[model samples]
Target chain A: MRLPYLLAGLSVAAVYLVLLHVGEGRQREAEEHAKQGHVTASYAQLGKAYALYHEGHWPLLDTRNRHFAYDLGIVPKGYAIKQEMEKDHAPQAVLFGKLGRHAALSLVPLVDFRNYFYLGFAVTTEEEGLALAKALRSGAALDRDIKVAQGTGTLGSSTLYRLHDDIVETLVMDGVLARQDLTLPGRIPVIVERPRDGYAWVVFLDMHVEHLRYPGPFPLTSKFVDTLESDAL
Target chain B: MLHERYDWLDQARGFVVLLLIVSMPTSEYAGDLLTGDPVLGPPMLNHGYEYFDGDPAITTFIDSGQALFLLVMGFVGYTAFTSRLRKRGKGAAFWYCARRVGVLYALASIDCVLLELATSGKPKWGDFFYNGTFAMIALGTLCAFLSIVVIPNADRRMLFSVGLIMLHSLLYAFPFFDHHTWYDNILALPKFPFGTLGMCAMAIAGSSFGQWHAMDPDNPRTGFRKRIVPVSTAAFVAAYCMDWVQPAQHHDSNAAMLLQAMYIGGFMLMIFFAFGEVGFRFPLLSSLGRNLLLMFALGGLFIGIYLDCFPKEFLLQSPYLALLLGGLAPIVILSCVAVFLDRRGIMVRA
Candidate 1:
């Protein structure tokens, strides 16, 4: 009876010790998993920076690079680029443009395309708009058979145009000429600000882009120009 | 028959038992109210002042009830030990005493219902109703015991008592089966059907022992002493062993283990002393144990209400006078009420 009791006591003690050790080990493993998750999040942020660089849109590329660098504590001295960029337009708008550009560029590498093209035209004057169109046609980077369409006059203003094709699309209006949807040459986007307060500013605006239609005569039509002023207001 | 004995010892014992039973559930709430720190939360440095800024009465009630219950239990235990012991006929008298307990239970039930209605449904019906039911059941148990000891039909007595025991066990375990509150499943019934079974078993067990004593009066103390000492020692040992094993979970740590062991050990000792040693009978002390149901119910309500009202400091103070008063006030009030009813012969039956 004494031996049996002794043996049972020893066995239970051994089991408890083993359980303690196992519990400690599990706790350590959980800590390691948490560390791994943090590292993975940091890597994702770095990947975003690399994509920004390839787009050649230095304004956006510089800003993202600096933000990540600051977060990682690698940059002892903060970069003054954000202060400079804010002097021109809203920081949010700049961020949105970069994100949109990056999304468009992601589509490029998937397709077996060699070159990507973008076009812009101001609709205020027919002559200036046609001149820009001629310039796009003549450019070595653009495809020869670029598709086009046009918008209709909804209000007093007449100049609104929508354009699209197998290779490229354009929406031109007064003070604006938007490249409707063109993939960047690589899996990254070029973030360039439209000339501030210039006639080209409308090219970056959403109203002209939304009115852009497809399956028409020119990549952009006279109707696109007619709808421009009404859409802008 | 009006028996104006007014035994302070008995009344005090009852008061303490009632306080303990009632306070068990309220202790958790009181801890929360006084500390302002919930059992599971960050410790509250300012006590429950922030949480219970508007409610002081509830805090006072809890503190007073806890302190008073502890005092009464301690006081009664001491008084019963020093006082002269009473010797009575074991078999028939035990049954008769148990049945008489039902009247006290009925009065307790009326008090419970009044308290429940006064509390505006804050306290659970189970807490109050279970007390009355347990008392009634205790009466039935006494009857069963008397039948076994006085009647000669052994087979019939054994069968009936066995059935009652099984039925009572089933009722106790009903909560596990239904996976619901014990009150709704067991206490909610009009006759406290499950508890009655336990009462019947107790009665039978009491009767069996009583009859054995009656048959063999020579050195009756020897037989009881032989069983009591060994069983008490084993229970104590078991409690100690349980305390030695520390579970891994923080909630199941050494402190909890020890507390649980002590509780079990205390219960075992109480049982052994109450039934095994007949010559050591103290009516006042045994009555407290016998009326555990009623006392527990009243204690629960008082504790619940007290915790709802007071802060921890009132109960945890150094001199302990505040704690003592806080705990004792409710029991004293309730006991006074019980005494008045006892005098009037207005016994309650659940």
Candidate 2:
């Protein structure tokens, strides 16, 4: 009996080690494929790496970003969002919203990990952005602690507002029919109005308030918003 | 009467069932109570802190409970299969097991459909095979049965399960499968809860222990103490070291899978000795355990009824009251139903 049990344990241990080696080899192969500019092949290898390691970071994001029309830095490597995409002219996915639909274009980590943060933005024309911002500031059932910061400051050159904790207010999404009934909890709203080459642009940033304080400052500023406005193709 | 000798198994099952129902049903309501700042308490839906979104505590609880449930299934199922094979014939046993898989899938479908009807007022037929607990259990049961048939020897089967988990890990490392979509469900064949391989491995591994227990039915306590306890402990320690090195979240990682299965194996042993051997009967738990499937359905029904009837506003007004009522209502009701059924010696299997 003891002999059988011992043998079984030993065999399991051996197999586990061998599988780990195989997983590591796959990871190395994925890197080699990536370096050789085998984009599709690299993606396939990285997909295998992801399946093997589960939580291990692989560079599948380059292809994912290209597929989703996301900026390279928008979603960090080693993190992924749910792959469900909204059927719209522009690429959009909900980050922590119910049933894969939300009013904001947010970059929130799908899975929780170290250095978790959220960045949501809705781009519009200057006239539309201003009118929308005005309506949001004067929205019905506003919380008392909510204060919308006017103009640029240490916070940034954009208009920023922090809603009180646990507060839920419905916001109207102009031109977007699907998100008309968008309600967010403890939303931190910001607007960056910038005049670019041909059109004036307004970028609305709707962030989760609690996340803003704990994870520290995001590597974002009015300059970045201006870059978005300038770089829009 | 046939199951009376291993009442500990029932008790362990009951305990896990209680844990699963309490944690799962009240998650949304508990979120409202704990995070009491949301306006429009009742009828308004406030998203709760979802599992696997970085909450270590909830993730550990869910993972362990889920693995343990399947482990119990494997243990109990092996005994049922072998006994039928001996008494009736191989064909009868196979069909018996096949019917069980079908019944469990049917239960899972009904549960999903009803819950969807209650919550969203629209039911998708695809939800019948969603990656819910029962669907996974059904698939795991199928795999375990097949493994048992293929690898007749107990030790080889145990080794086979370990290989199966590694295979699952290897498959999962690939990114073809999408979780939470219809494709993620076990019915999609080669996705999580089925294709993921861990759950099936758990069931097969559990059956090996069942083999051991059946070998010496008269002296099960001694056999369990001498063999199962130490082996599970060593596996637990080994799995822990693997997890320490890898630190993967939830049950996705190989380390987490092994750790959870062994951890629950040890927990079942503890429950067996503490409650089963000592003649210290916990009626509520054992009652829920005896008719696990029925209780599971009843628990889901009661929870659906509670959520549908009393929305967050009514519940969240008094958070403590809501927590107590929301968490305990299904548990208490199911225990009563289980006990009532058990008292009449009604054991509803499938």
Candidate 3:
């Protein structure tokens, strides 16, 4: 509003825009460093080892389940994918590419519309993830949500808590919810198994549902959780 | 802990922190998008997340989120620095600001180290370059730079701020420089010339506004706020059009940048007036906003610990579930914490 302020604001804004544009000008790598992982992998507190793919084990790929990244693999296809790849933080893997094509070809169901039942899987240890995978392979129920209950207190030198719950938090969601007893739809369950051997598995087999057509039993289900579990590291 | 004098600033500050915190998946929520019904739901997109996937457009949302914080940093920094400069003279003001910036730099570095350890198990130098904390470093650097260079005369400093923007345009004209140095000098210089310079531009822009406001903090220039709105609105429309035509993050024209700044200015003024007229109400948000810096640290810790202990997939089954359960839940806890801290007379003064 003040002429000086206006001029100055415009100038500063100009500098920022140019610098950003120029930084991306050559398009360095067109890759995101956020680490590739199953949707659930990004949820819990897994340290640096928390990504979907770690030590040759891919969270979704190893089991019957797979994560189709919302913007990463799906949505942007072919040329669009190639051009817009720079925006995302993860680089697409070959397997993700194949899944991208499959999703693109599918008809009748809009992938964007059914984002409700997306389940996530995470664990404290890679070994635990493998063990959970083993358990799922032996068949961990997909139609029911899993619960370890928050405030379970130190289970095995570590805390046994709610894997997930309502409330928008920053960074990590503090698990003390439902008065230490977390309950959700059984099928979309994440069991943050008690801290075992200095490692507690925080499994996020969860989904965020906004608008739904059917009232109960939110429709998404996968055979992957039933057959896949993590392999011992 | 709203200071009677600058409650609006405190409110806006907290809101910026809140907006940033809310957008990403938090310690509890993970911001996961899930379907309530598991009935043969479509598969998770392999690569993941489109900007348009949600009701609110993610890209524009992110863009708008950034708009206010940048302005706030400048407004707060300039006004505070000017007062100090008046009291202590140039030398004292310069060192005082530098010391404060040094503290910010130190904290920002710690955030980087913490993030790396949370994600990778070890702290590497690359983390300094990689994480968003670099922005903080840049902000601190800009504060020092502006204190010495632009804190002399309000009118001259205001004009100087405008000059920085024009210089930015000139740089774009050459367009041959590369920013790889931004990555290279991460450890030695931290946020050096380019990154610090760009941030400096934005903060100084805020300073110009602050300079104008300092003339009458209690009674801000009504005409200035009013005049900027339409100009900003029109500029925003123009920027949008430019974006539509060019549409490259890396190739936006200077004209586009000009309009975008105008738009952001307009948006900021609107927010100030809107909040002032409506009167602040959201206690949790205000609390979080008030204790913004401390919470930024605390919140980052919460995220780091959870992220390390749990993977993202461990978040609620879907984002919808996240919204209902994960989203609003933590605000209450955090706000209580703020109130508790405020009562104890504890706060991050910087």
The prediction achieving the highest DockQ against the true structure is: 2
RMSD of each: 22.8, 15.9, 19.1
- Error (Å) of candidate 1 at residue B107 is 2.5
The CAPRI-style docking tier of model 1 reads incorrect
Q: Judged by TM-score relative to the true structure, which candidate is superior, 1 or 3?
A: 3
Reference-based lDDT, residue B8, model 1: 33
Question: Highest lDDT, which number?
Answer: 2
TM-score winner: 2
- Order by lDDT, highest first: 2, 3, 1
Tell me, per candidate, how large a share of the native contacts it keeps. Answer: 0.00, 0.11, 0.00
lDDT of 1 by residue, B236-332 (tens): 4643453333211111112212222223333333444455444444343445543444556565456556555545554455435533545555556
lDDT of 2 by residue, A1-233 (tens): 79998998789778867766666466445434232222222222323343245332222212221221122543333323445455553443344544224433434333221111111222123322332234333541221122333332112223222222111221222121234323432123322222223222111222211111211122233343433333332
Q: Candidate 2 lDDT, tens digit per residue, B1-350?
A: 22334677888878777766765454554443223335332221112224214322234445555676777788888888887887888998899898999998888767677767887887655446636667778888998888888988887897787667656555544433423321112222244543335677888888887776766778776657765676688667767765544333444535455555666676575666677666997878888888987877666556666657677777767876675666566667777888899999898986
All candidates: TM-score of chain A: 0.22, 0.17, 0.24
Tens-digit lDDT track of model 1 for A1-233: 79997998689657644654554455345434333333222222232343355341111111222110112232122111132244444343222223212421111111111111122222233433443343333442221222233331111123322212211222233322255344312211111112222211111212111112332222233443333222221
